[model samples]
Target: MKFAPERSSVALFVALTRAVREAPVAEGGRSLAYDVIDRLAKVINTPGFKVELEALIALGAREPVLNSALEPFWQELHMLSSSSSAGSA
Candidate 1:
C-alpha cells in the first residue's frame, strides 16, 4: 500500500533508527547511531535536505508517537542548523 509522504517519512525514520541501533559494532564497539545522527545534522542544513527534514518534522509534530520519538534528533538538527547559519552570517 502506498503511504502519504508524512506516513512514509515517519516509517523511514523509525526503520533507520532501529536498524542503526541494532547494527553490529565493527571494531569501535559503537553503533551507527552516532555517525548517522552526525551526518543527518549536516544534511539538514542543505537546501533540499533541509526542506525534506522540515516537512518530516512538521508532520511529526502532529503525530504524537513520532513527535516524541523524533524529538531529540529533530532538536539536535535544528540546533546544528542554527549554529551553522550563525557561523556563516
Candidate 2:
C-alpha cells in the first residue's frame, strides 16, 4: 500500500474534519461524529493512522463539543496505537 506524504495527510485530515461538520447521519441512525469515530476505529489498525488521529485529536481539543465527542474514540485509538508501537519497538 502507498503511504501518504505528511503534507497530503495533513490536508486530507483537515478536509475530513471540515467535511464531517455537515455530514449526514448514517442510515443506521448514529450521529455523523459517531460514524467517523467508527470508521477511525477501523482505519487506525492500518499503517500511518497516527498522523490523522493526532490531527483530529488536536482539532478536537480546541473545540468543546468535538473534544467531548471525540475523546473516547481518541483514547481508544491512542491505547491501541501505543500498544502497537511498543510491540514494534
Candidate 3:
C-alpha cells in the first residue's frame, strides 16, 4: 500500500530511531553516540518527518532503496494529532 508523504516520513523516523537505539555502543565511540543522539533529538523536535527526511537527504542519502527502507510513523502522528487539535479548536 502507498503512504502519504507525511506518513512515509514518520515511518522513516521511527525506523531510524529503532536502528539507533539498537545499535551497540562501541568502545571509544562516544562521539558517534553523541552525534546519533543529537540527530535523534532534532528529529523528535522537528515539526514533521519531512524535516528529518531533508536532513537525511542533506547527509547524502540518495539511494531509493535506503529511502524506501525508512518508515513514516512520525508523519502519521503529526497528521493524527494535528487533526485532533484542529477539531478541538
Candidate 3 — which pairs collide? Answer: 10-72, 10-73, 10-74, 10-75, 11-71, 11-72, 11-73, 12-70, 12-71, 12-72
Candidate 1 per-residue C-alpha lDDT over 1-89 given as tens digits, one digit per residue, 9 for 90 to 100: 55333333345456547644554434232233444444554464454455545655654555445455555456545654565556555
Candidate 3 wrongly placed segments (more than 4 Å): 1-14, 19-38, 46-52, 57-61, 77-89
Q: Single out the weakest 10-residue window by summed lDDT for candidate 3.
A: 60-69
Could you give me the TM-score of model 2 versus the true structure?
A: 0.43
Reference-based lDDT, residue 59, model 1 = 48
TM-score ranking from best candidate downward: 2, 1, 3
- The candidate maximizing TM-score is 2
lDDT of each: 0.49, 0.51, 0.44
How big is the positional error of residue 47 in model 3, measured in Å on the Cα after superposition?
Answer: 6.6
Q: What is the alpha-carbon lDDT of model 1 when measured against the actual structure? A: 0.49
Model 3 scores a C-alpha lDDT of 0.44
Which window of 10 residues has the lowest lDDT sum in candidate 1? 25-34
- Per-candidate TM-score against the hidden true structure: 0.41, 0.43, 0.31
In the predicted model 1, the residue pairs found to clash are none
